[model samples]
Target: MYTIGQVAKFLGVSRDTLKYYEEKELVKPKYDDENGYRKYNPYDIHDVITTNFYRELDIEIKKIQEIKQSKSVTDLEHVLAEQEAKILEELAYKKRLLKKIKSVKEDYYKIKEHLGEFTITEMKPLEVKGEITEYAAYEEYETIRNSTENLKKAVTLTSARRVIHFDEEGMKEERFIVVRKIEDADKNFKGEVLSHPKCIYTVIEDGRFVNGEKSIDHEVGERLLKIAQDNGYELTGMAYINILLTTYEEGLERVFLEMYAPIK
Candidate 1:
């Protein structure tokens, strides 16, 4: 038998921790009437060591208590299997977050070079398999914001968020698309797949789309239309504006977008 302090030192824990385990009936120590001191048996010390080992695996105290009550090897196996599953889930979540961080960093740097300039280029086809939902302009920002969370949650992993736009009777309408790579076979989002054909696109960084500057839109839109027409290309559909970056300041949204129009 060893004193409470000796048991705690051997287990690399505090005396309070042993007292807590005793209160939970996990470790019981005998009280010495002669000196009025608590003494833990060797078996209790071993149990404390085992508890420490389980904690290193992030097993909760409740689960550890259940494990202590386990009667068979099968019960122990079940507990370990559950722990493994939780670890896998945590790893997958962290992997997705890391991917999002890396992508945002790359986009952040890439857009700095394209600010306030329009360039005509050949854009490759976009083959995305995920969900698409349209949103009204300047109407119920909260509704859209909630939907964004739902969409992001639905996707197991996402690489891009594409917002395509069109005008209907002078009202701006947007299509929100959240897509993952083809390799993400375990993707949970069950939405329509979007396939954009390769096209000659006039890509530019314009804040007027989300910032609500109609004057800038009218001027830039007309100039872009003329540029396409002069270069022997006719715009055939609504523009697909893939926002490269967006920043919010004082409740105002500013976006740098790359617009694509199918040309004939």
Candidate 2:
């Protein structure tokens, strides 16, 4: 038998922690009434050591008490295996987060690299006729492609001569294509006539199209609005994005996009 002080020294644990364990009924040592002192036997020492080992592995004290009481090797093994699986899952989740962060950083760098100095230009309101489809992003494009049958029906049925997109509320709201007739258009067609208000236009010309992603520099939009204000033009209505041409090479490695914009 050893005093609480001697047990604490031997186990390298504090006296208060041992007292806490005793209060929790996890480590009950015999008491000496003569001196009113705690006395720990060899069995108590073994339990304390085992509890400390489980605590080091981040197991809850209650769980350790349950396992200790049972002393079933299979139950303890299951707990350890479950904890290991949880650690693996957490590691995989963290890896995915890191990948996403890296991808975002790469996108930021690409945007910075491509955004050149701004230039202002004036655009005349010209009438165009063509088939127009609502612009869709990545996966949405696939859905649209399958639904529209590669846009053949949209172009043929409307007799679309030209297509244009107008940005509204951070997204392309109005997509118009100049067609022969606006009467009794199908479900996909919003037959409302749209026009741009008087505003100076900003333009950028890239020799090649940058894949499926539209190469309209939004920073140019800001510069254009400033220029329009300086040059006496009231900004009204949304800006129009016009794609002149989209060509893809046979290898799928290269794509070209020619886009123009008219801001109002």
Candidate 3:
């Protein structure tokens, strides 16, 4: 027989935890009234070790107590197997989250590198030839690209292409593209492109827009607009972004926008 403190020292558990196990009937120890101290026998030591093993496997305290009372090996094995499966599933989830976090960090560093190198300039509107179309809500570049591909198949001019995005009524209402000729504009382009008068635009330094990181475009554009306003430039006309490529294959390119302003 060993006192509670002696048992705790041997098992490396606190006396309070052993007391809790006793209250839960997982480990019943003898008590001595003379000292008002609890005493643990050899059988109690074995129970404590088994309870700790179950706890290490993350078995719930209630389940552990039930298992101990039943003394069923098959039931204990089932609980342990469930705990192992849960641990593996959680590990897989953590791995995926870590991968995403790494990818995001890499993108952030890349954008930071480009920020210091890019230049912003006010640009005069120029004629762009491409098919024009209306854009619906949440329409993305990939959808626009598919539309452009279909337009190319229908048109004879291989070189003419440009997409213009415009906002209307608090919604993304219109998309316009300039192709080689009017004869090439058709339903296949997915929307009608009416001639938009040339407006002032801003030009971003070449190699500013990165592929697989288009979200940076919005950040850059917003920052440029703030800079323009700070310089007392009145933003008046539609903004057009012109992407000039140095290496499309490597996603190294410059994007500049032409923002129109009323002559003050």
Candidate 4:
């Protein structure tokens, strides 16, 4: 027989841990009335060693108790199989999360490289699901939210607005719409398609706010027109804006956007 301290030292565990095991009925140490202390026999020490072995595998205390009291090999096998399946499921989720993180990092780097730079490029066709407007009701907002939630790939949250008409004064009417790349769209989808074969693309950083809402800088639109004329490209009067990201600093908000206007 050994004292609690002796067993704890030999097993490399605390005396309190041995006491806790005793409380859990994992190890029943013999109490010595004359000495006023607990005494651990070889059997009690063996039980503690087995408990530590299960703990090394990260088995929960309650589950370890179940394993200790298991009557058959099949019962033990079932519990272990459940744990294996849970681990595999968690691994899959972690893999997907890692992939998303890597993709977002790549996008951030790309934005930094092309920020505020203008170029002539062709964009793939997009399917407009619905319009996003300042005056939209809560029910309309919920409908759009539910629709995009089912998509497997990331959806473009904003396409800014389409220029309905342009005149000497300025744009006559503008309609804001939500769009996604055509490839990711579902079959039987009935919506307008926006395709720009050749367009002036540039990223704009806006920090203006009005009535607690972000407002785009119209000066950028004037600049786009000027640049297009200098390059001898005629404007098609259609503008498509894809918001890249938003950041806040020093109680101010900054919005980065990918702006495109069709050229003829």
Instruction: Find the candidate with the highest TM-score and give its number.
Output: 1
lDDT of 3 by residue, 96-191 (tens): 567545744653453445434433333322233334343222244334444332332232122223332322222122344443223433333333
* Candidate 1 ranges with C-alpha deviation above 4 Å: 1-3, 6-10, 119-133, 136-220, 226-237, 250-252, 262-264
Worst 10 residues of 1 by lDDT: 149-158
| lDDT of candidate 4 at residue 102, scale 0 to 100 | 75
- Cα miss at 86, model 1 (Å)? 2.0
Best by lDDT: 4
RMSD of each: 5.7, 17.9, 16.3, 5.6
Residue range 1-264, candidate 2, lDDT tens digits = 999999999989999989988987788899999988989999998878888887887778778877877758999898888778877876776775675457446534433443433333443333343333544323334333332222223322212222333333333344544432223433344444544433333223433333345554454345445555676654453455433222245533332112234443
Q: Model 4, residue 261: what's the lDDT?
A: 82
Per residue, candidate 4 scores C-alpha lDDT tens digits across 105-215 of 765775787687788898778767777553244444543554442334443344334444453356656766666556654566577887888988877776643224644
Please give each candidate's TM-score: 0.66, 0.41, 0.47, 0.63
Estimate the overall C-alpha local distance difference test score of candidate 1: 0.61
lDDT per prediction?
Answer: 0.61, 0.53, 0.53, 0.71
lDDT tens digits, residue span 53-98, model 1: 8888898889889889888888879889999999998887788677
lDDT for residue 125 in candidate 3, whole number 0-100: 28
Clashes per candidate, residues 3 or more apart or on different chains:
0, 9, 26, 0
